[model samples]
Target chain A: MTTYTFEPRLGTDRTALYVEVQQFYARQVRLLDDLRAEEFAATFTADGVFAPSPGLPPAHGREAIAAALRAAHARRFGTEPVRSRHWYNMLRVDPGPDGTLVTHYYTLVMVSRPWDPAPVIAPSSVVEDVLVYEDGELRTRERRITPDHQSF
Target chain B: MTTYTFEPRLGTDRTALYVEVQQFYARQVRLLDDLRAEEFAATFTADGVFAPSPGLPPAHGREAIAAALRAAHARRFGTEPVRSRHWYNMLRVDPGPDGTLVTHYYTLVMVSRPWDPAPVIAPSSVVEDVLVYEDGELRTRERRITPDHQSF
Candidate 1:
């Protein structure tokens, strides 16, 4: 068993920091559910990385992340009354010694199709994210999403 | 969006406490993987509650929790060469105002069947747990397990 430890700088308000980190994730999920892929990618740093799964290649940089997100949601985005929604919750935030924040949560993806009365849900994914606060704004440095089911 | 706020006592060693909490969870997963159902239930307080899914009645008390765990794993527990293994990861631990720990994580359950060379994985579940330290030992107060796929 490996023991993990962290020592935040003196006078750091951990409680407040935790709240801010949660809010950031809330906003990120909202952007994706609202079909704002560009905005969702902007939540990451300029040189951020996004991995959809463990064995897949990651998308590097803001532009690449945006492109990948768009491709993933192309079907929903192309249809009328976009119905894809992402629910993220139970976030745990940890501050790193090197000015980074690591957090993890489970995300549920649902879609409401025209033929259905309500949303059809998909299996959830666990997301592990590394973030950095730059210029008074928190941005993701890397996000690794591991889904329950493997398509490929 | 709602903002959650909690203020722990000013002099607590949160980082060290966090490590202890993680170790507790690690021990819990290990117990389950090793077919220690009774021991796993012992990790909870005497009056603990374990809920397998949303909208389901929770198993109350240590004895009941133990019974429920045994029932859930009956197939594997009764068979020879037990193949059930639980992989829990991406834990987030938080301290409550009244000396409790709230944590969440995604769990991947896999089974190594005699017919297959690789393990067959089940859909992940996100678990939310509340724990408290009693008599100098950490024990679970409540546990809620939410599976990714809902069977209607």
Candidate 2:
């Protein structure tokens, strides 16, 4: 028999903070998936750092982030018509220093072609993020993503 | 240029209720994925109704729900070892009559084998659920799943 272990539910559940974070991601992810690079990058702090994977250099700021996204988007979809959706699950929210919020969640990217019956799953990953309120809106200050196989 | 449209965010954001509902699904989906049929069904009310797909007949109660899950699990995993994960996204929660909570969200099933580099995505689906407090805990009273292709 295969034994399954449950992932730990981290931190105390803060209702207001949780809802606010969810709403933030709801808008942010759509921007990324829709290839709205500038809009997506705007959700980050001016000096935000995005280390998409351990092997790649982190994008340093909003301008770099948008450029990186645009380059990736053109490379992937330039050859064919495809749509991708980002899915998030098992979110953990905790309070950080200086009134910031720390969050961890699993992200799955599903890609589908016009003729495909279903989207194909990309390698699953977990993201660690530090968020702070900037002008009364939550913005990501730092984000580090680790693919499942690379996680300890 | 292909026009991209965003799904509407439904209902007012209710922090306590949203967190409660997410925690409920976090526990519930694990049970289902682990093939703990009895425990999975127990998350539903005794008279819960599960309409898995529009074309399939609904499982009328908890017992039937358990049985259906067991049968499906056996058939799928009997020949080969496979792991499936359920991912939920874009949740919409609303208050219902009589203090019930209604939820709508997208569900994606990703299936992987021991040798596969990454999981394969199954057809995407949307779930509509009505939940109520049972014994001080939230329980699903009705769940209706509709595949994206079948949805209007």
Candidate 3:
């Protein structure tokens, strides 16, 4: 059996920073999953830019982010009661210029309803986020998402 | 909207340890998903105990763990060409007595094939793990998995 070494891109010494970012995502994803648009948007900076994908227009600013999320929620679920979860793994954190953190991770969106026997897993995607400290708290300054299917 | 705070059980001071464990799982889960039973078991201590669920018997020691994993993989996949991914979220890490770390997290097992358009999401589960440092490396000493459906 071949032994695989766990070598992180940013090295093991950045555990504290990595954990901080992970916790940030933990809260951000939950807000989005719960459809708390305002709260979700608050996780980003006032002028944060979210480019969902190459084909879609990016949402700029917290207000636009909140509106886009609410619109997407309404269009997707409508009146149906459903629970959506965003699961992340294989997170990579790197230092960026100007004291920002560049993070990359795979996200799997799971959607299920009370009557459903199993949850539906959306096509996985990789997200690149530029995080910055705003008012002593970490927040997303910019985000770019690339779907797995589209990457190839 | 009511604000939700991200209060971790271990507090923010323990970010370094939390990230260390998260990285550990990143590698451990891949070994299991890829059917590298021996490699997966190596992430545990020599006398690690894994209780998969209440209905199943626990596997004690690395050898037993590896054998159990291999048997389960063969039973589930057989000759089928399927890909399995384990996604984790909502991880909580706490300090345990005797210089051990306790971790709790939710796990979602996703299975898919080359021909399948969407992956199937298994019932989510909560895993409780006790980790200890062996030879300056973190390893799992005990793990207990509780399926979400069985909790109630």
Candidate 4:
């Protein structure tokens, strides 16, 4: 995987924070591709909560969230290593009142198998996330995806 | 209209133009309310075109387009008053390639008779319009409405 250079700020040290988000995404992509335990654990914080924009329930806690992702991946992509794509449109990213929360606007489009060759759903969404910093590493305290379109 | 004073950009001139859009809206509202017209015109320039962001057909032309709107008003609204509450978010009215085209972000939440409380089937939409200026009047060169949520 090639390292991309995109520095989004949520207050505090910019460089370290930027690397953290990218690394998180990298681990996430690997976990999604492999559907393995260790990779998933590495990707998300222990208390990570995931909410797919549409057609899924709110997945809370690392194990639950990771399991949900794995199940969904298997259901769609099947046994063959699932290959996925991510599209994020940058609208506005700024520090929220909590100081750690970064609010941003984005549109996420995802496709899976057995359902159709084409994408299952694509929705424009906005998220507010609390980026927690501990031991020189940044992880998400909470991430809330709001008012997503439901077509999947 | 209580004439709320905003910046020059959001003044009477713009509202007047929007009022014109409201008039265009009225034709359909009137139709839904069981009204007819001998001749009604909402013309865009030759190069005018509508962009449907979500899942609506985009149209162009003068008489054809006007007739289309009239027909739509007839079918969709059908002589019922549209209790529309619209908020025009981003409207950039300036000279276009041919004449004038205005681009804006709009959220229209309205209720028409027979469907007074149906959970807003047609959710608030994001709209962009290309307009034509003629004889000190604004005409729609093109009108595009991209729905926030679409079934398909």
Query: How good is the docking of model 4, by CAPRI class?
Result: incorrect
Superposed Cα deviation of residue A53, candidate 3 (Å) = 1.7
Model 2 lDDT vs. the true structure?
Answer: 0.79
Q: Candidate 1 clashing pairs?
A: none
Local accuracy by lDDT, each model: 0.71, 0.79, 0.80, 0.48
Is model 3 an incorrect, acceptable, medium or high docking prediction?
incorrect
Alpha-carbon TM-score of each model against the true structure: 0.59, 0.58, 0.60, 0.38
Going through the candidates in order, their DockQ values are: 0.10, 0.22, 0.20, 0.04
**In model 2 chain B, where is the ten-residue run with the lowest total lDDT?**
B1-10
Model 1 Cα shift for residue A68 (angstroms): 0.7
DockQ of prediction 2: 0.22
Q: Give the least accurate 10-residue stretch of model 3 chain A, judged by summed lDDT.
A: A1-10
Could you give candidate 3's per-residue lDDT for residues A45-90 as a string of tens digits?
8889989887899999999999999888788889877677778888
Number of residue pairs clashing in candidate 2, backbone atoms closer than 3 angstroms, sequence gap of 3 or more or interchain: 0
User: Looking at the true structure's interface, with contacts defined as alpha carbon pairs within 8 Å between chains A and B, what fraction does model 1 recover?
Assistant: 0.00
lDDT for model 4, on a 0 to 1 scale?
A: 0.48
| Candidate 4: tens digits of C-alpha lDDT, residues A9-72 | 4345443344455466555555565557455644445666677643457777777776776777
For model 2, what is the alpha-carbon lDDT of residue B10?
22
Model 4 residue A12 lDDT score? 50
Tens-place lDDT per residue, model 4, B1-152, is 11112234324555445444443443332332222322333334544555445455655555555555566666776765543223344435553464354566555533333323221324667777665555555445566777766634
